[model samples]
Every structure is written in C-alpha cells, then in structure tokens.
Target: MDAREAYSIKVISEIRLERLGLLYGETRIKDNDYVTTVYLKDKPILEGKISLPKFIGDDLYYVKSEGSSALMRQSLYGEPQKVVELGKVLKYEPHGKGLLILGEDPLTKAEKDAPLVTSKRKYRFDGRGLLRTRTSLYLFDNKLRKVIEGDFDVTDFSTNGKRIVVSTSQPDDDVGLNALYELNLDNGEMKRITEKEGSIVALTMNENGEVAMLGHDRGKLPWAIREVILPEEGKRFVCGNTCGSTVLTDIFDGAKERLIFRGDEILTLGQIGGEVNIYRISDGKTEKLTHGQHVVRLFDYDGESLVYSLTRPDKPSLLVRKDEIYDPNPNFKGAIPEKVASSIEGWGIITGDNPTILFIHGGPHTAYGYSFFIEFQFFAQNGFNVIFANPSGSQGYGEDFARRCVGDWGGRDMQELLQFVQDVKKQYNLTKKIGVTGGSYGGFMTNWIVTQTDVFSAAISERSISNLVSMCGTSDIGFWFNAIESGIEDPWTVESMDKLMKMSPIYHVGKVKTPTMLIHGEEDYRCPIEQAEQFYVALRSRGVEAKLVRYQGDGHEHARKGRPENMIHRLSVKLEWFNAHLK
Candidate 1:
C-alpha cells in the first residue's frame, strides 16, 4: 500500500456547493513525497489538478500556500497568482472578502545556521527543531496587504468577517495553557476572552459570531465542548461526559451551521479498543457519522454531504463519501482478525492462544481504544491474543486519572498496565507466553516494566528513552518534556536530576532478565535512537539477550508513515523476536 498524508479538504465555490478541493501528499517509496491538489464534484470523480503545498477555497477564489509563500486564483479553474510572501502557513480561512492566515515568521539566516535551542525551559514539541515558533495571526486584504499582526501561537481561530475569535498561548503563558482572545480586524484591537485554567483550543464561530470552543480545563478530564457568550458567563459545556477528548477539526456556517470533530470511546475495556470517530454537531444534537475500529483524517461536512478518508486495521485509507467510497490501496487485503469490543474494565478479545501479547499505547496522555491497530491485528492474526489498556495518565478518563502519573511516569501507570495484564491472564487462563512492546512513552514504560519485573517472556522497546538525564539534553523536546511530565520545576537542578535518574529505566536495567529487542528510527529526534542504543548495550552487558534494529532515514513515526517496506520490516522483526522467545 502507498503511504500518504492527506492535507486539506475544502468545499469550493459558494455557488457550486458540490465542487470540492483536496490537497494531499503520496509516494510509492513513501519517500520523496510531493503534494498535489485534486478537484472533485458531486461524485468522487476528478475535475482538475492544481498542485501546491497547502490550500483553501471560497466562492470566487482559492488561496494556497506555495512553500512558505502565498498564491491565489480568482477563478475555480485558473492559474494561481502570487498573493504574498507568507512563511509556512499552518492554516488559512476565508474572512469576508479578505483572508486570515495563521503562519510563522519568515526564516532568517541566523535561524538557518542553528535552528534548535536547548534549555531547561520551553515544553512544546515539533518534528522541526524547536526554538518555539509563535504562529502569528495575519489578516490580509484581497490585494494582499497585511492589516493585523499579533505575537501569539494560534491554537485555533474563527471569523465572520466582522469579528475574529482566536485561542492562543502567549510567550509568557504556562507550558500547557492557552487563552482565548477576540481580535478586531478593522482597528487591530485585541481583547482577552477566557482566562480559565487548562488549554482552550479549536475555535468555531457562526455567522452571528456565536463561538464554540474545545476547553481542556484543569480539573475536567474530558475536553469540554463549550459555548462561549462573553461579558457575563464566559463559557458553558455542551458535552464533556463523552468519556473521551473531543477535538474540533473544522467548522462551517451555511444555511445550517455545523462543526466537525474527532473523538474515541473505550468499546471493550482492557482488550479490544481504539475507535477514532468523526462527529457532527448541529441543532442541539451530536451525530456520529462513521463506526467500527477506524481512524478518520481530514473530515469535512458541507451541509448536504460528508467527505473524508478512513483507515482500519485490515484496510488502508481511501477518500470516502455517503454515495461512493474510494479505496486508495485496493490490493491491501490481509488476514482479517476477529475483534471483540467491550467496556473499559471489561475485555475486548481477539481469541487466539495463551501467552498473549500485552501492547501499550504511547502518550501517557493518549489511549488504546476499539480502533483498528495494524500491529495488534498482525500479532493476533499470527496466533497471539493482543491485550491493551488505557491505564492512568491516558485521556478519555477524567483529569485526575490523566494527571496521576505526571510526576511518576513509571509508578501508577506501570501498576495499571501490570494489573490489566493480570486481569487478562486470569480471565483467559494464560501461562508464561506473555510478551510486551511499546514505542515512545510506551517504550519508556516497556523499559520501566522489564526493570521492575520479568513477567513477560520477551520485550520490544521502540524509539524509547532509557535515561532521563541524558534524554533531557538529547531529545528534541526532552529539555522540558521530561521535567514537566514529571511534574518538576526544573530538569537541570540537582534534586530534579536525582529524581529523573531514579525514574529512568537505565538505572534499573541491571535487574532486567527478559530478552529484549530495541527497535528505533535512526533519525528519531523525539526519542533519539541513542536512547535505544544505550538500553540495548545495557541489556547485552548484563548478559541478557538483546538486539537493536535501526531504520535509516526514518523519524519518530516510522511505523505510521515511514516507507511501506520499513513498516512491514518492523512488524516482521517484532513478530520474529516474540515467536523465538515466547514459543
């Protein structure tokens, strides 16, 4: 299957409601990727081609970002004219007869020399080296005159031509906090809106400027989908008991105003989970459009129809609609593994045999739900019962549970994972055939688990961090991620360094007896490949079986977006390791 990244989806021409524009990147090697735009109408038939980096459209014209620059076309089918020299436009929208672009400052010669700045402060993480870019909000006239410019990292924003609502985190704001502000385009006056705790992101406003925002309040667990009516009561929740974090992706206001969002539910508790869903909010009701274990990317609703791409455990993604579905990888047919969905505490069983594999998801903040996971399905289809859980520090639960492991990554989260393993073993009458594997923070946990106990027959840690002290200086965002996630004030201080070393997996590697496999991407800066190298060496020096597999020219997300052959090779390596040790 070809690896691809779908960028933007927009309804073109206010008069021609059915014409749609999509920008995406694809490659057979999944390397040397290039971006291209395709126009589609009522059916999913291609109308024309307009290649660009990023794009958006309105009635009379289409605005596109041409590699850190701007271009616009007045007609639906016409050559794009240079609009302005905007640098790396993250997002753009049609405002009145003008345009509002959220982008970074133009690159400078100094920045090009040494882009990344390492320090004890700064918590944000991006694939690109980080000095922390404050994505400014630019209001431009149709003639490309910049009217309004502001210094803030734009989280989300919406405008109705008269007023603009923006959610931003200023330079002085805390590591994870974002504040809401209303920007006046005419006079360029800015007024702070929400001053509450937690990050308020993803802004959506109707034609009348009725704003709805996604608020991840301090004490609230689920992301609060709230309606904001300023000057009196600031915000009120529409729904937050959905047991998952709701992210507002895109919203449109036509005759009927609508908002598009993504979230998940824990179908079968400790076992078969992960369902990333696309939702519609309108007229006092929340409607879930797609079901089953699937991942939806770049979904948009245009009043009468929905257009999106979906990926599942057994199937690659494709452009899909109500009347027709387009499969990009039609030849991607594998052994379809059986899936059983259950409650959070209950089990989602893909029945196979004893000695099942216990998989852990990354992002001590993210989760494992009833979604189609390729790795899990691969293990299950290969005669291994794969059990995973959304332990403490994961979203979907409430704030307390998610924040429980902040200062203690391996403490409660380890217990939750092991306890879930015990539950699965007892329920399924499993023996010593259990193996464990995870990447990133999950990789951190895998490293943590092997040091604490040798319950698993085999272990695989991918793109993991073993030493917090070393990771603080080496990782792309480790300077802050290590301490902030550990609930510390400063990572470089003696007290914090001592605690970090104690929490680091390398400190306890002497006790690890389980055969371990360290798989990493050579180019991973998030959890640099050196982290894996250190762990593999530690295990080998202790006379324990360990092997390191490094993927060249790959980054942190090798399994998800790396070359197709590399992804397959990763699965094969994990499979071979477990098959050798567990069997």
Candidate 2:
C-alpha cells in the first residue's frame, strides 16, 4: 500500500458490549477530513464528525465538536437532542442514575476579563493545551449541577453511584503525585482517603466497597511498574512486575481499563515479552487469560465472553469475541513484520536486502511489540526494510530493565540499539547504508546516536529533545519529568545543570555528521518545538546536512493524528529523504 492508501485504511478505535447483547465499535478514517463511524452489531448506525459515543439505556449519547462542544443524545424513536452544553468535557461517564462529568467550568465575566496568570506548576498539558481554570466534577440528574468544585485538578475517578472516589493534585506538591479523596453525592462532602504521595493511573470500586487502584507509591521512579493496591485494606496485590496498562501506540485513543473488578477477580492488561495481554488476578495468584502475538488495545468482559480490539503486525485493529472477529478494514492488505531473533528483542520486515530503516519507539518506558504501525508499513511498501527493537530502557520486561536507562539516557540503551542494528545487518547480510527515525524519546536517541557515531546514512528526529536545561522549563511535564528521569533532585542548581547537559544530545551535536531532518509541531508542548530549532541551528552552523519541517496548528501527535494531508506529506518527505541519502 502507498502512503495515501495507508492513510485511508479504517482503524477500529474502540469496542464495547452493549447491555442489549449488541457489539458497539467506533472506527476512524482520514481522507479530506477525519470521519468517525459508530457501529452496532457490525452495522453503521451513526456517522459524523463526533466521537466518544456510548449507549445509556435506550438513548445513544455522543459528543460533538464541529463548532462548539455539546453532548447530544438520540433515543430509539426520536432525533438527536442536546442534553447539555459542555464547555470542555475532559471525561464523562454514567454514574448511578445520572451522568458524572469532569470538565473545566465556564469562565466568569470578571475572571475572563482579568489577566491570565497562574501559580500552578503544571499550567499546561500536552493534548488539552493551556489550563486556565481548575477542573470540576458536574453531576446531571434533571439538570447540570456542579457537585465537586475545588482548587485542585482531578486525574482519575471512580464511582459506585452514590459516592465517588477522585484522585486529585494540589498546587504545592509534584503534579505526578496525587491524593485520593472520597466525595459523597448526597451531602457534597469530601474526605481524604489516602495520605500517601503516589500516582494513581486508574482505579475501580466493587459493590462491596472495596477499591482497587493501579499505581505506585514512588518507591521507584515514575516509570515504576504499577501494582494493584487495595487502599482500604492496606494490602498490595502482587499481580506481576510488568504494568497492567497499555503502552504508547499511535493507532487509537480508546478507553484503557487498567484496573477493573470482576465478580471475584481483578482483570488488567499486562505487557510481557513485547506483547500486551489481559491478566486475571484471584486468590493472590496472577493468571494470563489471553495469549497471542498481538497488542490488545481495548477490551470489555460480559461475564462469559470477552470482547477486545487487537492489532497485529499484518492487520489493522479489529474486534474479537470467542470465535467471531469484527474487522473494520478486512480488505486492506499490508506488509507484516517478522520477529528478528536477536539477543535484543525486536521485529522487522525484510524487503530483499533493501536499505533498512531502523525505527525506534517513543517512551523509553514503552516497548515496540506486536502492534500494527502504519508508518512502518508505509516505509516497507516503499521498498525499505523496517526494523525496530525494545532496548534496555523499554517496558514489558522487568522493573530493572525498564529503569536501566532512567538516569543514563545515552549509555547502555544507545549501545544496545547500535549493537542490534549491527546484528540485523550481519543476520540479513544487508548493505552498510541505513536510515534511522523516531519520535519523542526515540527522537532524543536518534540525535544522541548521530552525535556518538555516523553509522546511519540519514536520521529523522520528530518532536525530539536536545537540551535538558531548556526542556526543564519549556516542556509541559519537563519540570518534574526531567528532574526524575535524570536523577537530579534540584534541577535549578549549577551542578545539576552540568549533569543534565552531559546527558543531553545538543551538548554533543558538534560531533554529528549524519544527514539529519527534524520534524516538529508548532504547538508541541511535550517536547516543545524549540528543541528541534536548537538542533537544526546547531547542525546548520556546523555545515552539516539538516532540514526541519514544522506543522502549524498541530501538537506532539502530528504524525499520528494530524491532518490527513500533513500525515501523508510527512511520510512522502521521509521516503524522499531516505532515498536521496541511503538508496
């Protein structure tokens, strides 16, 4: 398939089992505009520029953002009606007999007219952009009502109809650590449940009032493997060392149920040996329920049957239940990545000894596994062998492996990646010419790799970080992420600055000779576009071959969910650059 063909392939973003024994799935395709289609029983029921649809009772509820944000519902026999006007709904779900919404409150007249200023450390987030107001929980029974409004921001929440458990972050402490609180819907009273400083990624409550949380108590760094903790019982359930959550993937933004309660068991997704699968924990023993070489994106269980959306190396996303398969793009054909038997775990597609493009995944914590990547398939279809690996810093291994390259970004992990490239070349007897590309943390490694050695014929770094000092202040999570990742407690000190510089790729850019291209979005707050600008200027000043492509009105996820034209253009440019340099 060509780049445009790959872009046109429909991907199943989400799947859920309706109470009426009907399967609900959401799919997305991009051409002139991104279109989302909701399916019930494998038939299209709703199609438009809307998203996050769910069926509550007899009404189909969905969110529309064509012009303004609004929650609309359609009954079985009536047209769509506006339930309420949501200013900026972060998350909403069915709670008890009403709907619980977490969103930014509407701005007041005086506050909107006043100067925009905040003392909050995390004043901006990556996907949501700038944060001007604190988020509050609103309950809708007969009408929309603000139930829990506070000075803090809610991270994750769970409810049992009558009461709600919310994880909140205050202004003083680190934004990554949150405190749990229980809020009563009857009297609007709130009480702190946990006094420990930790991060709760997801949580759920059973009917017996037992709460299961997936988080760590800062024993290790932020990349610590999340455990299932019974907060009230003060007992941590040993599910496994690997985290039971989905790693970073570009295909979909579906619901990730990290921790959920079944009748007597706790079900969660766990990554092991580069594959994410479902696991069930009961009687203090963890059992792997599903097995295969595919990444499970989202899943739901209805007592007897389990329905999930999974993607393989050769296939896009599809729904699977018992013996039935609900593939959204059944006719779309593409290349498949074969497992590369090397000491370092990896996979690749060989195009008959063609010039290999070594791709690295972002999230020094996220591993590259049995997931379908459109970008890789596009490169392979264009006559290049695409190869990727899970180096030392990647997750899905043990906690020790995940934290190996925590403070040492370019140390062992970089060496292992270079070694893996050499092993692939030797195993396949390929040419010396090779191209390297990656985004975010992978981009940082690409920059670091070129500075260390010139083995690659070309390099493309997308949404990369070049300097740690500037990143600490510029990036949205930089203040805490950089400090914790680099093992520097006091980032503002002179000694810490020197240590961070030594680990940064920009400090060693003068030694780079590989032809490099930097791609970044103008609104990327995670890496910030300035990181690319600094590296581009450094390479140009040194008279090294370099190019920078900037996408307007896009963020760090430009390559994944940007405009269709921009996504295709980015792929074409990559192929053109690699062909000119390597082939």
165-203, model 1: which lDDT tens digit per residue?
887766334254676778877676778876664555455
Candidate 2 per-residue C-alpha lDDT over 371-414 given as tens digits, one digit per residue, 9 for 90 to 100: 88888888888889999998888877788888888889989888
Q: Quickly count the clashes in candidate 1.
A: 17
Clashes of each: 17, 0
> How do all models score by TM-score?
0.75, 0.94
Query: Best-fitting candidate, measured by TM-score?
Result: 2
- Alpha carbon lDDT of each predicted model: 0.60, 0.80
Which segments of candidate 2 are over 4 A away from where they belong? 106-115, 171-174, 238-240, 253-255
